[model samples]
Target: MTPRTPLAAAHAAPLDLGGRTALVTGAAGGIGRACALRLAAAGAKVRAVDRDREGLEALAGQTDGVEPYVLDLTDLDAAEAAAAGADVLVNNAGIQLVRPIEEFPPDVFHTVLTVMLEAPFRLIRGALPHMYEQGWGRIVNVSSVHGLRASAYKSAYVAAKHGLEGLSKTAALEGAPHGVTSNCVNPAYVRTPLVEKQIADQAATHGIPEERVVSEVLLRDSALKRLIEPAEVAEAVAYLCTAQASFMTGTSLSLDGGWTAH
Candidate 1:
């Protein structure tokens, strides 16, 4: 007999976010955009934060409950303050550069750490007081496969992601008693504009032609050949906020096509 999967079984309760507010960083596009739309569809009033104002406007036009908050995450105090009064917080903003550690620009490296790691910390800090007061909150960190495994030519990204993993776990432990759950959703090579840009950067960094980057470099470790969809990653993020997932905190849910299983 085939075992019943999550999709195979009928859901006893549908996701309902009425009276909830969700804050999604990087909500201008990719998985973050999908998450913002999904949560809005579930009746959450979504505060969609992004550095790109144009992208945010376009995204806001397509969704009913998503509103844009335009700010660069490098402003740590602003980032933290922006997260106050949120019931669900999806920390999904990040940037990447493909270069050897010696060749990596110091400024770029610092920016990556600030955006990916420190900003999330500050945002969580800003969010916790309200969550602890209310006795409920969700923190979903959009980590990457890079967080769990190292790759050559991406020193800043790998370092920042690894640090994020530690922070997510620490937050989980501290927030547990207060009904705040912190977890990471780690996906590999999702189809997004960021990845489209990385294809060229990886090609140049790995010294391979652009045409062969997907096959030779990006999917080399992945058991699945194709890239994950943004919506699929959003579904994972959505699941984490459901009542069924209340006990599932401090763990990483990997969408890496079995890359970690190896």
Candidate 2:
């Protein structure tokens, strides 16, 4: 017996991303901000990308090893270029427009698809070469409950998330042979600016008061009637980067409070 391998030593070691480079898009705030900080804490140098220069500057002020890269993901070429040479790629940038399909502006729909779906494809494409050469990488796509289910007046968001899920799975299959893993983290109604902005829109769309939006609309299907914090979602993203999750790819880790349980 090898002294039982020392349970604490074998199983309780902290996640260490020492010397790794992590590229996180939409890192100016919310989930992306949380992820940047979390990975930095784990000893990875984080390349934080976003269009929000002020926000990125603010984020960089709070941490060491976080380099702010101001680039809007809608610029497909730039988005791809920014992902080069990253050991970890977190595609977490997205925008939403809550409007019925019939009322949706075609230009906005195109923009939504371009930013949310096409940008991730380009980023993953850019990341794979470096990852494959090194034979290890982690890709985490921050998706939403909308990726699996749908709600009225959220056509563009639903479409983008659905597309993201498909893209993530495809990457998982292709990258498996190269020691890279791709996965999605689907969270519902996070307590972030995105969700905060949606309250008024959802209220108008559902013909309800804004006060009722949280309880009656957002949490209606959730078994746990609460909004998830950005840090909570970031923890899941961090887990996927660890060795324990090496075999878990091409699937979604839903932090939906059982929204999909039904």
Candidates in order: C-alpha RMSD to true structure = 4.3, 3.0
Candidate 2 off by > 4 Å:
1-12
Over 1-262, each residue of candidate 1 has an lDDT whose tens digit, in order, gives: 9865565234547788899999999999998999999999999999999999999999999978988999999999999999999999999998989998899999999999999999999999999999999999999999999999999999999999999999999999999999999999999999999999999999888788987999989998899999999999999999999878888899999999989989
Clash pairs, candidate 2, are none
For candidate 2, the per-residue lDDT at 168 reads 100
Q: Candidate 2 on 97-172: residue-level lDDT in tens? A: 8888899999999999999999999999999999999999999999999999999888888999999999999999
Runs in model 1 lying further than 4 Å from the true structure: 1-12
Q: What is the TM-score of each candidate against the true structure?
A: 0.95, 0.95
Clashing pairs in 1: none
Candidate 2: residue 21 lDDT (0-100): 97
